[model samples]
Target: MKIGLYFGSFNPIHIGHLVIANHIAEYSDLDEIWFVVTPHNPFKKKSSLLDNYHRLEMVYRATKDYKKLKPSDIEFSLPQPNYTINTLVYLQEKHPGHAFSLIMGEDNLKSFHKWKNYEIILENHHIYVYPRVTKETTETQFDGHEKIHHIKAPIMEISSTFIRKAIKEGKNVKPLFPENVWEYLDEMNFYK
Candidate 1:
């Protein structure tokens, strides 16, 4: 089976995440989109992140209804500062039968060079890029990679940071997440 590995912190999964996953699954050759919850993303700040297990659970709850969209804990057992290349290598070794491809925004590709073994990842795996409007494309580097698909996914304009900020301010986030998922988040006081 072909899988689109979407790596993110998922401090709390929102509807935007679901939409992107759905879009990738529908448009790409990928049969599944795995939300590989990063315990520690090398590019992100650690202070704002919630517990990995809690974050993972929230992802589990948010993606429960989507068979193609799953919450993965692949980084949980890996070393600190979870690197994408390392994770991909490990996943490939563990799941020999499944083909894994990278799914991310054009913005992320810009910073790809700084990642460990970024070139190797680019050479080996297919990348599915969905346009993220706010970020600049010129500054983001793709290096004329082959088999890179550009998809027009729904622009939800939402981020986990934005949702966390709303929670910290005690603001309503009813529209941010799916109905049931939002209720569960509120009940658990997740971001608080």
Candidate 2:
């Protein structure tokens, strides 16, 4: 099976996320899209994130109804401040029968060179990149790279940060999330 790893903090899994993941799963060659909920992203501040379990649960609720989309807490058991390279290696060892690839935005491709062992990652795995509405330009080095594939997926402007701020301000952002995810966040009073 070809699995596309859609890694994210998923502060709260929102609709934009599901749209992109579903688009890729249905249109692309990948058989499954795993929302690998990161416990801590090296590029993000941990203090602003919700508890790992809470975040994971939200992802679970959001993706549970979709056959092609599934939630993953693989990074939770791994060491803190983990890098994508390490996680790729660990996943390969655990699921040798499955071939894994990365699902990222064009914006993240701008900083692709800075990731730990990025060259090695490219050598071993294919990357499926979706469009993102960002002003920053992508790195020229990745231009026409064989390991990288540009997927013409929808550009999702919705962000977890925006959703969090809206909730904290007592604004209704229920439409931004999956129905079950919205219910869970509302019930738990998260981000308020």
Candidate 3:
């Protein structure tokens, strides 16, 4: 099986995430898209993030109805401040029968060179990149890389950060999230 790993903190899994993952799953050659909820991103501040399990639960609720999308807690057990290269290696060892690829936004591709062992990641797996509204251009090295595929998926400008901030301000951001995810967030009083 060809699986695309769409990694994110999913501080709250919103509609933008679902749209992108669903688009990739249907439009790309990937058989499934897994939302790998990260426990801690080295680039992001841990203080702003919700508990790992709470975030994971939101992802689970959001993706449960999608046939081609699933939630993964693979990084939850891994060491903190983990790198993508390490996760790829561990996943390959655990699921040898499955071939893994990456699903990323154009913004992330712009900074791809800075990731740990990025060359090795490119050598072993393919990348499906979705459009993102960013001011910076992508790295020249990745412009026409064979392993990198530019998927014509929707440009999702809605961000989890924006959603969290709105919720805290007592604004109605209900349309940003899937029904179940919104319900869960409301029930738990998260981001308030």
Can you list the residue pairs that collide in candidate 1? 110-140, 110-141
Check candidate 3 and list the clashing pairs: none
> Each model's TM-score, in the order given?
0.93, 0.97, 0.97
- Give one digit per residue, the lDDT tens place, for model 1 in 4-32: 99989887888888999999998878999
Task: Summarize candidate 2's per-residue lDDT along 17-101 as a digit string, tens digits.
Answer: 9999999999999999999999999888889999999999999998889999999999999998999999999999999999999
Candidate 1: C-alpha RMSD after superposition: 1.6
Steric overlap count per candidate: 2, 0, 0
For model 1, what is the alpha-carbon lDDT of residue 48? 82
Measured with C-alpha atoms, the lDDT of residue 96 in candidate 1 is: 94
75, model 3: CA deviation in Å?
Answer: 0.6
Winner by lDDT = 2
Off by over 4 Å in 2: none
Write down the worst ten-residue block by lDDT for model 1.
135-144
Candidate 2: residue 167 lDDT (0-100): 95
By the lDDT metric, which is better: model 1 or model 2? 2
Cα lDDT of candidate 1 equals 0.85
